[model samples]
Each structure stands twice: as structure tokens, then as C-alpha cells.
Target: MWVLVFFDLPTETRTERKVAARFRKNLLDDGFAMFQFSIYMRFCASRENASVHIRRTKNNLPKKGKVCVMQITDKQFGMMELFHGQKEVEPEQPSQQLELF
Candidate 1:
């Protein structure tokens, strides 16, 4: 599963870079990859991993800003590709079917 996070905050010319740096550091610490400015992407093996990242981001944010987080399954990513006219190929199924005779 992959998670996407977005956030908007008051424009602080001086602190923008600093804040962004801190945010990136925190996300990296939480095992997230930087997808874009104010956005993060993360792959988790379990829901618990996702939750931990969410909680940490929320806790580490500055006092005077707004943030939003979204979690999307691999299916959602495929849908995004479809919008761009990229069809996703499905993997082949096993040829042998198991059944009790």
C-alpha cells in the first residue's frame, strides 16, 4: 500500500526552505519517500506502518499550518494511469486450479 500526503501552510519566505527540510527529514525518518514539495509517498507492508507515519507527521508539524494525508491502494494508482491513457497490464493467473474431487 502507498500513502500520499499533502499540506498547505502560511507562506514564510525565510522559513520555507527550513520547514521543507525539516518535513523531509521527518518523513525520511518515518520511512517515507519525497514525492513533491508538500507531498510525500510511502510504501508500507502493513496498516500499522502507515498509521505510525501519519501519527508522526501530524505530531511533528508546525503549530500554525494545515496538512492533509491520503492513502491509496495500488488499484488507485492504476486508475491514475488510466486517466493518462496508460492501461495497466494484469498478471497471468496460475494455469492449474486446485479443486477437491
Candidate 2:
């Protein structure tokens, strides 16, 4: 399971800038890595784990601007295509899990 967070917060004012920085730091402290300038991603042990992190993200959302959260399976995330100079490249898929039951 993966949790992706996308946010765009107002940063024109000094206080707004501080709020944005604090939000980013919170995401980092929560184990999310920066995928883009304002996008962060994290791998969760399970769907429920992802949900917990998602809730945390919601709680820290900035008072202004837009925010979006998305949950995706490893398989679905693998299908994401990246384009560079007109060439389409699929993202590397995560290794198969070895579950012991």
C-alpha cells in the first residue's frame, strides 16, 4: 500500500511560509518522501496503516490552498508511465511479497 499526498499552500506571507514549511516537515517526520516539490509518498505495511497516515496528513493540512490524498496498490502504481523527451517509461515495480501464513 502507498499513500501519496499532494498539497499547495499559500506562502506569500511570512506566516503562510512558516505554515507551509511546518506542513512539509510534518510529512517528513511521518516517513513520507518528496516525490515532487509539493508531493510526498509513503509505503505502508497495510491498507489500515496507510489509512492512519492519511488521517495524520489530513490533520496537518494548511488552512489555505488545496490538498489531495490518494491511496494506490503496488500493482496499480507500477502502471504509472513517465514521459521523458517523448519516450514512455513505466516505473519499476516493487518486488513480490513473500507472505508466510
Candidate 3:
């Protein structure tokens, strides 16, 4: 599963900019990578793990902005089409994680 976060936060004021930066930092700290400037995504091992990250994203939402959270299965994510300028490109594959007991 994948947990994706989309946000549009107010950044006209200094404080608002700070808040926006903090939000991005929080997402990065929580294992999300920047899919775009306003979109962050993280791959989870299971739906339950995705739910945990989704809850964390909800907990740190900005005070005055729009935020959207979405979850998609690995197959769905793999079906995405990516392009660079006029040329098509392949989407990145998720990294394999090691589990140790």
C-alpha cells in the first residue's frame, strides 16, 4: 500500500511559510518522499501500516490550508504513467526493506 499526502498551505506570511516548511519536514521525517513539490508519498508494507501513517499525517495538518490523503494498492500505483517533457519515463520502484528478528 501507499499513503500519499497532497497539501496546499498558505505561505504569504513568514509564519505561514515556516509552518509549511515544518509540514514538509514532518512528512520527510515520517518516511515520505517528495513525489512533487506539494505531493508526498510513502510505501507501507500493509494496509494497517498505511493507516498508521495516514493517522500521523492527519495529526499534523496545517491550520489554514487544504490537505488530502489517499491510499492506493501497489498494483494501482504501478499502473501510473510518468513522463518527462514530451518523453515517457518509467516510474520508480519501491525499495525493498529488510526485516530482522
**Predictions in order: lDDT:** 0.68, 0.86, 0.92
Predictions: Cα RMSD each: 9.2, 3.8, 1.2
Q: Is candidate 2 or candidate 3 better by lDDT?
A: 3
Pitting candidate 1 against candidate 3, the one with the higher TM-score is: 3
Error of 3 at 97 (Å): 2.1
Best candidate per lDDT, number? 3
Candidate 1, RMSD to the unseen true structure: 9.2
lDDT tens per residue, model 3, 1-101: 88899999999999999999999999999999999999999999998888888998989998999999999988999999999899998877787877688
lDDT per residue, candidate 1, 19-90, as tens digits?
766776887887676655777777655588678778888888865567788877756654553222475655
> Number of clashes in model 2?
0
Write down the worst ten-residue block by lDDT for model 1. 90-99
Q: Give each model's clash number.
A: 0, 0, 0
Question: Best candidate, TM-score-wise?
Answer: 3
Q: Candidate 3: deviation at residue 42, Å?
A: 0.6
Q: Give the TM-score comparing model 2 with the true structure, all chains together.
A: 0.81
